[model samples]
Target: MKTLAIIDYGMGNLHSVSKAVELVAPDTRVLVTSDPAQIREADRVILPGVGAIRDCMAEILRLGVDDLVREVSADRPLLGICVGMQALMSRSEENGWVDCINLFPSEVRFFGNHLKEGDVRLKVPHMGWNEVYQTTDHPVWHNIPDGDRFYFVHSYYAEAEGNPDIAGRTHYGIDIAAAVARDNIFAVQFHPEKSHRAGLQLLKNFVQWTGA
Candidate 1:
C-alpha cells in the first residue's frame, strides 16, 4: 500500500484528514510528520492547512517543507485542502496584506461583496455545502459528477487568468473556484472529509488514483 504523509504545519484539521485517507487506503500508512525529510520520503503528500495563508507559507518556509514539497511534488502526486489549496496558488488576499505561495500562477482574493448591486446577502466566509461545477476532467474528479455538493468554509476564494487551471467550481451567490489542478498538484478550497459520503468517496478516489 502507498504511504501518504499528511503535512503538519501546525494549522488546520490535519488529524481528521489523515483519518479520512486511512478509510480508503488503510494499508497505505498515513503518517502525520512535520519533518521535511519524512515528508519527502512518503509515497504521496497531502498538504493540509487551516489559517491565514501567510502563516501557513511561513511555516512551510520555517520548517523547510517548502523545498521538500517542491522536490516531491515535481513528479509525485500532491493534494492541498482549503487554505492548503489556496497556498498552492501564487498569492492570497487574506494574510494581512497580499501574500502568496506562487505555485500555480494565480492569486486568492476575498469573495467580492457583490458582483453587481442588489446582491449583498451571501456570507463573506462561504460556509456549508456547495455544489461543485466541473470545468474539465481530472483524476481528482474521477467518478464524480457535476453539481456534487461538498463542505466549504472560507472567506476568500481563488481566481486564474487565461489557460484556466480550474477543475471544479461552486456557487455561493458568486461562482468561485472550488478546486484547481496543474500537473502533479491538485487543490480544493473545501474540506472533503467533512462533506459526508460524497466527499469520502472523493478522498477514496484520490488514494486509489493511478495517475498520482
Candidate 2:
C-alpha cells in the first residue's frame, strides 16, 4: 500500500484527518509523520490545521516543514485543509499581516466583525454548514455536486488578489473563498472530514483523484 503522510506539525487536527483518509483510502497507509524527510518521500501529503495562520506557519518553519511543504508542493499531490489552506496564500492579517507559504496569490483576513455589515448576517468565523459554489472547472469537483453543503469553522476568509487559484466559494456575510487550487497544490477552507457523508465522499474522491 502506498503511504500518505499526514503532516504532524502540531498545528492541526491530525488524528481526525488521519482517520478520515484511512477510512476512504483503506488500502493506502496513512502515516502521521513529523519527520520532514519521511514527509518528502510520501506518495501524497496532507497539511491540516485548526489555528491562527501565524502559529501554523511558525510550527512548520520551526520544524523546517515549510521547506518540505515547498518541495512537495512543487512536485507532488498535496492537500491542505482549513488554516493549512490559508497558509498557502501570499499573506494573512491574523497577527498584523505576515508572509505565508505563497503557493497562491491571495490574501487572508478575518471576517468583518459586524452583525449588520450589509449581507453579512452570519457571525464572523462562519461556523457550521455552508454551501460551496465551484469557482472554476477542475477535476476534483468532477462528480461533486454544485452548491454542496460543507462544514466550516473559521474566523478568517481568503480573497484572490488576481485571477486567483480559486476552485470554489461559499457565501457568508458576503461571498467568501471555499476552495482553491494551483498546479499540484489543492486546498479547502472547510473541514471535509467533519462535513458528514459528503465530507467523507470528498476524502474518497481526493484519495482516488490521481492528481489529474
Candidate 3:
C-alpha cells in the first residue's frame, strides 16, 4: 500500500501523469494534491510541470510547495518531469532570467533561435522523439535499454555544472542532459507519460524503486 503524491501547483499535466502512473503501478495509491501534509506523507513524490518557467516558479512559491519538495526530496524517492526538472535548477535563462528551486546546481538554457545538424537547421522547440543515451547506470533505468527514444517537447534543457550528476544524455544539435540523479532524487526533461513503452517502463521502475 505505498502512497505516491503528485504535487499539484496547477501547472502540470496532472491527469495524464496520474493515469500513467496508475496504469503502470496498479497497487500504489496515486494522490494528486497541493497539500503539504499529503505530499510529505507519501512514500514517493512526483513534481511535474508544463508551462512557462516564470509562471511555474511563481505558483510554486505562492503555494509553498517549494519547501515541501525540498523536505521530501531530502530522503524520499522524488521524480521531476519537464518544467518540473527545470524548476529544480538554480536558475533559468527563460523569460529574462528567473530563479528556481536550486535543488541541483544547474541552469536551464533555451535551444536558441538557430540550431542545425550539419547544413540543415532544426526547429527551436525540439519537439518529437529523440534517443536518450544512458550516461550512468541507475536503478530507475532497470529493464530499460540504452539508446531508447523518449518523447520530448521542450525548448529548454538542463546543463549541470559538472558531469557527475548526469544520468542520461541526448543530442538535438548538441548534447543535452536528458536525465539527472543524485541520491533519492531523479528528474528528466522529457515527458515519460507521453513516451510510450520505454516511458511506461521507466515509471514502473520509479514506483518499484527502493530509493537505495
Best candidate according to lDDT: 3
Better of 2 and 3 by lDDT: 3
* lDDT leaderboard ranking: 3, 2, 1
Every candidate's lDDT: 0.80, 0.84, 0.93
Q: Candidate 3: which pairs clash?
A: none
Candidate 1's error at 134, in angstroms? 1.3
Q: How many steric overlaps does candidate 1 have?
A: 1
Off by over 4 Å in 1: 112-120, 160-163
Candidate 1 or 3, higher TM-score?
A: 3
Q: Model 1 scores what on Cα lDDT?
A: 0.80
Ranking by TM-score: 3, 2, 1
TM-score quality measure for candidate 2: 0.94
The C-alpha TM-scores of every prediction are 0.92, 0.94, 0.98
The number of the candidate with the highest TM-score is 3
Candidate 2: segments with Cα more than 4 A from true spot? 115-120, 160-163
